[model samples]
Target: MLSLPRSRSLLAAAAIVATVATAGSLTYSLGLGLTPCELCWYQRILMYPLVAVLAYAYYTADTGIYRLVLPFCVGGAALAAYQSYLQVVAGGTCTFGGCAAVYIRPVTIPNQSLIAFCLIGLCTLGLAVRTRRDRT
Candidate 1:
């Protein structure tokens, strides 16, 4: 198997997640004709860049990129969490508009928010592990 080094692998994972997330959101809006609300747009803004950031970091094998990516991840996570909260407590009723899912009801939550949660986990892992060594 062609395997990347640890740091690159982490970046690759994050990149994959962000890519999938961006594609899914785009599909929801463009293919299914589902519109994204203001909060969803905010989360999208945070997510789309992660795809580029992680991909470039992985390609360059930039060990320092994980920390740089943390802010976006954390922001996405917060938005996802708040979105989830709104779904549960407030019934996803946005002041600007409302949010909806593509699927019928196997799951009652928004899939994009779930992706954000997963992205949050991947980013946390990226930051928690020491993908590089300190120069003495």
Candidate 2:
């Protein structure tokens, strides 16, 4: 079995999360014929590029890429969290589709996106910590 360095492994994990989130969103909108709301679109904007960004960072073994990626993760997380708030708390309305729409019963799309963004953020933070510790 081949084991990767912690930093590289964390980048790979983040890349995987981004890929799955991107794929799942695409599946929901394109395949399942579910229309995305405005907030969903914003979350997608933040999430879709992470697939390439994290993958390229992993390919180049650039641990410092966290500086670039973390903002996007944070933005995505904020958007997802807000959407969740709208759906669950505020009973808000979106310009595009319905923010309150829930296809997976208990778990809304924004909630799932939130999980993915948070996971990617955590992995990136872990890599940052590991890189810093290694440097000192």
Write down the worst ten-residue block by lDDT for model 2.
88-97
Best by TM-score: 2
Task: Please provide, for model 1 over 1-136, each residue's C-alpha lDDT reduced to its tens digit, 9 standing for 90 to 100.
Answer: 2224765666777788788888878977798777887878888888888888878877887766767677777777787677766676765454434664334356422555566557655764654465533321
Residue 20, model 1: lDDT of 83
lDDT of 2 at 49: 92
Residues 16-129, candidate 2, lDDT per residue (tens digit)?
999999999899889988888888988989999999999999998888898999999999999988888777664544435784465466687888999999999999998877
Error of 2 at 60 (Å): 1.1
For candidate 2, the lDDT comes to 0.85
Alpha-carbon lDDT of model 1: 0.68
What lDDT does candidate 1 reach at residue 104? 34
Off by over 4 Å in 1: 1-4, 92-96, 100-105, 108-111, 120-124, 132-136
Q: Please give each candidate's TM-score.
A: 0.80, 0.90
